[model samples]
Target chain A: MTVPALSVQGLTTHFFTRAGVVKAVDGVSFDLAQGEIMGLVGESGSGKTVTGFSLLGLVDPPGRIVEGSIKLNGTELTTLSGSALRARRGREISMIFQDPIATLNPLLTIGQQMQLAIAAHERLGKRAALARCTELLTQVGIPSAEARLRAYPHEFSGGMRQRVAIAIALLHRPAVLVADEPTTALDVSIQAQILLQMRELAAETGTAMIWISHDLAVVSSLATKLAVMYAGKIVEQGPTAALLRDPRHPYTAGLIASLPAMTTPGTPLTQIRGTTPSLLSLPPGCPFAPRCDKQTEACVQKPAMTLDGPRGWRCFHPVGQTAGAPT
Target chain B: MLGFIIQRFIQAVGVMAVMSVIVFFGVYAIGNPIDIVIPPDATQEIRLEAIRRLGLDRPLYEQYFTFLANLLQGDLGRSFVYNMPVLELIGGRLPATLELVLISVISATVLGVSLGIYAGYRPDSWVSKTIMAVSVLGFSVPSFWVGLILILFFAVHLGWLPAGGRGDTVMIWGVAWSFPTLNGLSHIALPAVNLALFKLAMMIRLARAGTREIMLTDTIKFARAAGLSEATILRRHLLKLISIPIITVFGLELGSTLAFAVVTETIFSWPGVGKLIIDSIAVLDRPVMVAYLILVAFLFVTINFVIDLVFALIDPRVRDGASA
Candidate 1:
């Protein structure tokens, strides 16, 4: 097997709130190899986003990695201090925020903002940083990067601003890029353009990527491997093609069926029946059992992720034709 | 830009006209100058003669036009109290006040901004907390109260410095080779500090809010991700974000500072326009009061104009709005 570029072992994050402790990402684990795009697919409360944040140590106050081991190229990240982790961030890894508007400062000129970006890690002269900023802006397909440099955030359209943000993330050329739904906020056409550019950039840079999204359609098109998360745990993991063609877990099967498939054009789309279990008060047994069609009475005892044949899944009983059922 | 300026000029003229009318009627319509200066026992004839002397008995419109015409010629009527040309009296006191105001604003901006940046970057630290607490106390307590506190402890109790005044007239100017300039500066420092600390509190609170909000943005996080040193981000990002708000507050505050200077100038016995305006108020020297008010109003209007111009220069979006 190819050595994984990143391995998240027994990764867990919990939050203490007024209600109770939230197991946002409970014992989640996955691996990504070099130059491979891993899709982390889940619903809003499934902890997919939280898992990505944990890998980067970007979880804000009150939410923390309670138990986990994140090894980025075999180096433990959980032990890194704030300064050390910051050093690792742009040099080795970068994350794209969900909202482009909330990301760029409204008051600053794009050139000045980009200058800070380049000068942050390198001790280059002002002119050199400016030159690099122009290069990166141009690389991200901004029209007239030179003229656009002097423009403020409000001056640009939403698509253009997101492009600028993408340039900022790519300027340092980090080894691993975590895009938490980068194109989720854009219009359909702009979304396609941005995703195409992102895919091209990833291939060119040969960077390992974790594309976190709720829409299976977007990730299935871009990622080489797919990991389906239920509640706070990974319910299934396999090659993207295999998972899409033959999902091993009932939850994953439900997810595939829910998509608006061309093969069943007139038929009503399949969507998971029940709500995701709350991390704060998860039901004993499989978190997805309440929503699972093939769950058994034994599912109430709780099931741990177990390997089924060649894939991994966390289900007490599979969908008969599927493998990797949790036991 | 030229069009924006012309628009502002028109607005300034209208505002000044309205303000002048209020000053004229607010002071004149309240009571007779004769009743104020002479006894209530005085006869109507005496009051009428007093009113005629002050040019209050003329047709209201004629009086206004004559006042406006004289204003065009820089001739405000003679002060009833000072018994001198209103313009000339202002000229005499103006330099002292101008000097005090310039000193206060300069000192306040430097001290306030430096402290504000420090307080903003480390909100949770003791340095930030202490500054925040001090800022609250500084804002709530009156400027004059702080002035009294300084004079009591430093000038009276400690005897570490001279109490007040610009200086003995002999030492006012002339050749200062040694610490003479230093001594003059030392004399101004107490009152200047008194003026500055309160304004400092205001700027600090403003900066803290601006910085906190800026810090939350993606750009700040992106900059940090670049592994750029904290100092670099502060110098480049934090300060730049701060300039827009600081410049805005500075412009408006610059205008009001002239008005506030009166209070500070009076407390420390520092000679400035503020003190001159106050003296003119005590005697109902209407013309002098009117001239000073107009002079102050003029300064405010010009400062605002310049501020808008700067906003246009730094940001193009403002340019469009200013024209519109």
Candidate 2:
């Protein structure tokens, strides 16, 4: 079998606070093929971003990857030293941030930042690096790419700044790209444009991407596969189209139902009923059992991920399984 | 950019004009200097002659106008204490003060910023904690006390350096300077460090705060995500981000150092304008006092102007905002 571009298994990241251990990403597992896009969907604090940070070994103190194996192209990244991990970061796995302006240094020109990124990974001459940077900017649909290189971050509009950020991420053409809500801060129209560009670029470069966002609509259109997270664990995972049409987990169902389009125009929009439980004092069994309508005595005990071919879910009484039957 | 600078220059001129008026009127409001200068046994004619010659017999407005006119003609009046032109007296003292302020500022900034970067980078480390503790002491201790302590330890106890005064004299381009000799350096060292302690502490705190704040910012995270090494991140992102605040503090501190060097100079018996100001104030030397205040104000405005220009040059946002 061909090795996946990125493979993560039993990934558990925890934060040791004064109160207790907060399991930000507990027993999460996923796989991505080259050129595939996986939408890591969650509410705020659902550990989507933490999972991304963990993959890059970017988690700071008080938080650590307690247990996990993140293998990229069959190379175990968790076992690598800091310098080795840094070497692989921009060269093999790069990230684009939510706020593009934050991703860029305001004092530096676009050219200077791009050159620094280039120089970090490669020893290209100044002329070659500028040429490469210009090409990447052009690829991202920036007009007057060469002239725009001299412009600082503030000179560009919000949308253009995001494009610059995306271009910088793509400069090295890393094997995997982690985009942490890269477009959520942008205008809707600009978001659509960036989404379209990213999809095309991913295909062209065969770069596997993990796009983390709270917006399901954008992810539904962009990603081929989807993983729904609830209270720090992947509650459901499957093909995006299949999962959206027939969601197995109640949380997934509620998320789908809560979409404004799912409800009749005159009626109120459906909501998930309760907020996500705090990571500090999550219930012993299932994290989402408190809010789930389908919860039973069996749910009080954590349900191990039950897989049926490629699709899987962590619920004892899933939607499609013997509806209303007592276990 | 040019327009912005010109506008700032005009604003500075207006500020200096307003300050001159305040200093002129405020000095005159104090007890008349003639009372201190002329003896009580002097005849009425002698007193009248002294008052007229000193421009004190004229109406306040007339004196102010005369002062402004003399200022326009590049004259700061004559010092009653020294019986010399106020400008000449200030000119004689300006170089020593400049040298002291310059040396102190450079030493403080380099040491403070370097130490601050280290502390901020590893805030949880013991070294950082120790530096922070020392900085707290640096901020709280009075400069005069610090100057005394420095003299006691380095000069008195160790007998390694001189206790006070600008040492040897050198003339270069017809301008007298404290020669860059060992004795000269030793004499200036104690006072300069004493003058620099508080500002050094402030710079360290500012730099530490600035660094810590910048480290948490998203741009720095992005730089890390982009695979830039820690050193690269520090150089490219952290340093640049912290620089604006450091520069601002440095500029303001430079002005304060010149203004407040009175304590340090007096402690070390260093001959600077600060010492001159203290002496003039005691003797009610109005011309010297007024000239010094106005000169310090001008220096402050000029420093701020330069800082703003630097801000514009370093940050394009400022540059764009200025042009806009």
Candidate 3:
């Protein structure tokens, strides 16, 4: 269907470590239709950012995409050469880093930084490139962007810098934007503002987004579809409302329950016991079985994703009786 | 910024003050001038009178004040050995020394930085390995030794240029704009090259290290992912990050070049402050000796300040902070 704006199938990324080969992304798969926002939600080390970095070919040595078909608009990105991948990045498929401070070059003025990104993908002269830089900055809701162009990264407050970074990423109007924890480092108020700006921009540009975060609330607010990952696999995924309304994986229930809410204050918050297992020593059965509250004998040998109803789940006895209002 | 400048100037003064003390004592520390002037047997009263007239009988502090006053007034006192104004003696030799140091600094900075960027960009490659090999060679060999070897092979043996002296005596100021000598440059050239060789190695090594560090930065990796060309990456991103360390090392190298000029000047028989100080000290020409010592100290401080400015220009953080 319209080649899905982005399609990932049987995607796996592994890291060869002294301990062992860690399967960080064990055959995780998903799709994002054009203009769709896909929320890839997980706690730390769930391979969410890794997956995003992989899509843009940002994974460095030691960690590699061993098996995967990452296609954007039907053009395969996984197999692209280094130069070709770079050309696509920030131009056709850009990334907004979790800590924008780390993402931006501190030495250059915003204008120079934006011009560099624009020049990397476009054939325009510096004068034209600067004009477009101001336009993008203005589009991202940065006031007085023309004057701000001369200001370096350090001068801009944290939220402002992230906006400038976002402006730079959108300078060439990429089709896909991968935002990795774009709000995690910001103050709550600033985070809300930046997120709002991003949502508006996504709508205005019709950019397909892979929003990666541990905060399901934030994701649910922005993404129509959601994938919950544990250890290194997507244990459950479906339409955001359906998954939130009736999460089918015990771990998914634990995550949703753990989220702060008005209704759950009196109900002792549910927590998935134990940490996500180390990838090197992942249980032979389901990676989350050691921590899954609904584990059984069938969980000892890993339950493969079974198509049940409208979503996918990797549980022998899938979670039943979704959250209901006792009307 | 005013505070920084004032502080730096105070530090410079302190250095000059110490250098003056050492110059004053050490320059006059040797045996009395009478021994060399009159066969060591001049009548005691005559020698005493000579000393008194020359103000040698004054207390050390008084003599120091006199020397300071003379220096402030641009009269570097008198060179007892040269029998001329101390300022004139240094003035005569200053150009030769400046020329040598300029050539050496330029050579080391260009060669060292180029080699460093290349080695860093191609670590473990044959080109990098070759550069490392050459750097090791350049580092271990002493500059004087390098000079000797150059003289032996290129000058004495090959006879391409004059073996010594600022060219033949005939060419000395024969033309208003002409330099020390045609033959003399062959000698000066080797010595200058020798002086710069160590700095070349240092620059390359430091540059390579800094470049490698810069290369590891996420922004650089991001730049690479964004499809920047290798040339653009190296020139715009790589070089800027390494400028601070390179400038730092280069400043130190420049200071050492001033210090080492004495040795190089002696080797080539070029009349620079290095040789001027030595010749003054040999016969206890205290004024010229003090002048040259203070001059070298001044050169070191001034060069370091300029290097700081260069570093600030390269790193915006520093520049903004300093300006702020």
Candidate 4:
């Protein structure tokens, strides 16, 4: 079989704070084929964004990738560091951030920022770079690419700034793009438009994506697969429709049940019983135990990942199963 | 933009108008200069003649209007001590202070920003810690004491440079500039450095704080994710983002240092406007005092205006607001 576009196995990243070590991303593993979009779903502090940052080697000090293998089309990324790793970043796998307002430099024009990004990896001539920049902008549905390039980030509306950010991220047309809630700060209508555009772009460019967001509904519309994280671990992952329809992890069940669409229109929405545990002091086995209604004594020891074809989960007593049923 | 400049200009004029009134009466309250101009032993005829010659025998309001009238006529009267036009006396001494302060402030900004960025970028490094320690010393040490120490070490102990004075000069644009000659440069070095220490510390603190904050921003992070080198990120993004505060402090320091490099000037025996102002105050030279104070007010207004224009140039957000 042809190699997957991106493969991550046993990824673990930790932040050494004075209080304690924060296991931001612990043993996250997944694979994305060309053109596939994987939605990494988690609440705040659940390690989804950290996973995205780790993929690009962008974690700052006091935080480090303690162990992992992140391979881009069969080329190992963890082995590279400094300039070598940076060279691979935008050219091989780039990322888009949550807030367009804060991500783009206020002092620089869109054209200059794009040029700077382009110059980072290649030595393109001015005319050629301009042509490429205009093409990318137009492709991202920005009208008047020529004049828009000279505009500052503030000149663009919130949605338009995100489009500019997307255009810049797509400059090198890398194999993978990790988007960290690129639409969370946008209006709902704008978010829908961007989601549709991003879906089309991924298909047209054949670029794999790891779309990180807490809004399961938003991700379900755009992503083919999903991974649910809790306390730095991926508790369950599978094809999006299958996992949403038949969530085997209690945490996933609570997330799906809490959605407004899933609840009776006038009734209170379902929510997990307890808050997420602090990463610094997670329980030895089953970080979700305190909040998992189906939690069993067997959960006192960590459950090995149970898999069926493309679907998998890490729970001793999963949803739809009696608490003491055979493993 | 034109409206903005015009508004600033009108504001500057109003400020000068107010300053002139304040300076006139303020000097009047500082005891009559006639006391110093005419000795106690002088005869009544000599004293009256001295008061008449100095325009002091006129009523207070009459004297003020006369001074104001002369001011509008491109004259500041004559300095009683120097026996020359007040404007000419100040103009002659301004070049020395201008060159000295310009060199020091500019050098301080450049060196401080570079060091500050390094310290902020690598805050955990020992070098950064050392830089921060030195900056603290810079803030605490008195400038006069520092000037004396600088002289004692670089001049007296090392004997590598002169102890005081503007050593030699080259005439440029009808003004004597000490920067051109080797001897003059050596003479200006200690005093410039002495003046720079406090400002350097301030700049370092400001820039360091700005850099530290900006480095954590998504702007810098986004730049890095796009594979921009660390140096390029620092230069293009971090520098521009941190520059507004640095520029503000730079302008303020430049004005303040120019107005009050008195201690360093005194220590170095540099014949700048600071020295000239001190001597005028010693003998209570009224014309020189009023003119000097007004000139200082004008300098501050002009510097602030220039800083506003510069802010617009560097930041597009400011430019948009300025136009509106």
Task: Name the best candidate (by TM-score).
Answer: 4
TM-score, one value per model: 0.89, 0.97, 0.88, 0.99
The 10 consecutive residues of candidate 1 chain B with the worst lDDT sum are B170-179
Fnat for each model: 0.51, 0.80, 0.44, 0.84
Q: How close is candidate 4 to the true structure, as a TM-score?
A: 0.99
Per-residue lDDT tens digits for candidate 3, residues A79-131, read: 88877777788778887877777767777788877777777877898778878
Instruction: Compose the digit string of candidate 4's lDDT tens values, residues B164-194.
Output: 9999999999999999999999999999999
DockQ, each predicted model: 0.45, 0.80, 0.48, 0.87
- Identify the runs in model 1 with alpha carbons over 4 angstroms from their true place: A1-3, A16-20, A125-131, A262-268, A308-310, A321-327, B35-54, B102-121, B168-180
Candidate 1: C-alpha RMSD to true structure equals 3.6
Query: Deviation in angstroms for B111 in model 4?
Result: 0.4
Candidate 1 lDDT for residue B76: 81
The RMSD (Cα, Å) of candidate 4 is 1.1
lDDT tens string, model 4, A158-243? 99999999999999998999999999999999999999999999999998999999999999999999999988999999999999
Lowest lDDT sum, 10 consecutive residues, model 3 chain B, at: B169-178
lDDT of 2 by residue, B144-238 (tens): 78888899999899999899899986776665577476677777888888888888899899999999898988898888888999999998888
The candidates score, on chain A by TM-score, as follows: 0.94, 0.98, 0.94, 0.98
Query: What are the candidates' C-alpha RMSDs?
Result: 3.6, 1.6, 4.3, 1.1
Give lDDT: candidate 1, residue A8.
Answer: 87
Better of 3 and 4 by TM-score: 4
Rank by TM-score (best first): 4, 2, 1, 3
Span of 10 residues, lowest total lDDT, candidate 3 chain A: A318-327
